[model samples]
Target: MTEDLTGKRALVTGAASGIGAATARWLAAHGVTALVLVDLDGPGLAALDMPCEVLPFPGDVTDEALWDRIEAEAGPLDYAVINAGIAGGAPIATMTLDEWRATLSVNLDGAFLALRCATRLVRDHGAMVLTASVSGLKAEPGTAAYGASKAGLMQLGRVAAKELAPRGVRVNCIAPGGVDTPIWDQTPFFQEMIAQAGGDRAAAMAALSGAATPLARFATADQIAAQIGFLLSDAAGTITGTSLVSDGGYLL
Candidate 1:
């Protein structure tokens, strides 16, 4: 059943591209009227042309002051997608402190700031979804920093769920295994894979997904966005604190 978001308002971080942009579009299509989009990519955020009211805030999510302004300016929201994050990996032995901090600063700290604002401004009965990763649940080599950050995010969402329960606010985590998103190109690992696949991004992603997942395919941005939408909708009214892992059998 289609979730009717008519007259609802939402805040989506990392709205410039990837899962964030997909989620924004999803919400807009589902009848959300006002969407507050936050992303560092100003042009990308501005490029999104949706039917709803799009309020773009181009800034780093880690900036507390930026979040402060958003809290003061953006009105109360019915939903929040705390999804701004970066991807990187290295063996713990080789990962520098700077690399570790950089990942956590965005994936964890930035998420915390967004959550703080959402928890405060979101109306009672509103829902929020945090983007985590399968890496957080299943350990793998060279994913120390990224995995740790996502693990922290998962825990944070659970705690927020408990604290906000009294207010009728629902918080959950979406831990996707592999999805076709722009975040992959930002990482050297996937770039190398793309190059090796004769510059065909699709081929590379397919190869990776086939190797990693029992389903032999990765999800699309829209698929992940739909899952997030489900979690944020009234259909999930009784669900909170749990994680919906959309991993294509990767966990198995």
Candidate 2:
């Protein structure tokens, strides 16, 4: 068990699914009291049962006005985890402008907006963590847009830490490789991932189990969540403006 964030409040974008959802639950385990959960998943957030006083807001994180409204309503928080994202894989020549914008808007721009707003509403020395990805560190032929956006998020966290430091706040980023999240069930990459296992998801998943990565296998969302919970807690008081990669060794 970590330090209980009993009196602290929090806001997590993309709180209804995957790493976002895992983090919210992990914080609850450490005794969080208030959570303002934001995501397009209305019913999903509503369905969550936790001790925290959860306020679900359905909206896009890319809108500046959305953050303004969230800050006005959610009050001060102790931590903010920016974890929403999309996977767009296309060569630059074939990718449409709208596709590029969409990726940047949600993955990069959205994170920036949430961080900016959280900066205003968190306690002076509060903490913030952004979810970047292993893709940010490695670029592939078809994943240029997604990779660039995440790379941008990593940089954003550094700049945010610099801006928020004097104010007593800290900022950091998480770059996860692959996590066994439901989104994999919906993305085309899952098929490619499956093919890598010789036309079997289970087998391909096993193959992805990391002959290359030091940790081996895909990261479970819970695994990523634990790190997030740590950063938000007092345990990480001296840490900021850096990245915590949770790819189970995909980058190693």
Candidate 3:
């Protein structure tokens, strides 16, 4: 069932593409009045066409100044989807300090800033969803930084939920496995992985899915967006501090 969000406002981070963009569209489809979309992609943010009013903020999510601007400009938010992240892959022994910092800066610090701002600005009874990763729940060799950051994000959501409960704000986490998104194309590690499958991204994805994910396929961006939508809606009013795994049984 599509929830009616006619008068509500939402803020979505990493809004230029992938799951973030998909979630913005989903909120608009459900009748959200306005959206505050944040991302580092200027052209991508400017190009987005949505049904609701969009206030695009193009900047680094880790910047406290950006959050200050967002809070000032966005007014009262009814929902927040803290979904901005970057993937980093390397064995801990070989991973540079810079690489590890870069991953955690976005995946963890960014989430913390976004959630802190959201908890402050969201109206009472508001809700939020954080994009975590299956990597956090179950680790593999090359996921040192990414896995640690996501695991931290999951725990952050739980703590945020507890602290915000008194104010009627609910916070939840979504730990997605492999989703067919442009992120794969952008990450160097994934590019190499894709190359190993003879430059066929789909084939590589399928091979990985077959080997790891019980469902044998990648989750679509829209699929994850739908789950975010549900968590933000009234139907999930009682849910908080829960990490909803949408990984096609990858962890299983």
**Which candidate's lDDT is highest?**
1
Of 1 and 3, the candidate ahead on TM-score is: 1
All candidates: CA RMSD in angstroms?
0.7, 2.0, 1.1
lDDT of 2 by residue, 1-252 (tens): 448788888888899989999999988877889988988788888888888788788888887887888988888888999898887787889999999999999998898888888888888989999999889998768888899999999999999999999988889898888887776665676678886767777776666565537777788899898888888777888999999888776765
Q: Write the per-residue lDDT of candidate 1 for residues 11-105, one digit (tens) a residue.
A: 99999999999999999999999999999999999899999898899999999999999999999999999999999989999999999999999
lDDT (0 to 1) per candidate: 0.96, 0.85, 0.92
What's the TM-score of each model vs. the native?
0.99, 0.92, 0.97
Could you give candidate 3's per-residue lDDT for residues 59-139 as a string of tens digits?
A: 999999999999888889999999999987888999999999999999999999998888889999999999999899997
Overall local distance difference test of candidate 3: 0.92
TM-score of the candidate numbered 1? 0.99
Among these predicted structures, which one has the highest TM-score?
Answer: 1
Off by over 4 Å in 2: 192-201, 210-214
Scored against the true structure, residue 154 in model 2 reaches a CA lDDT of 95
Candidate 3 lDDT score at position 214: 81
Write down the RMSD of candidate 1 (Cα, Å).
0.7
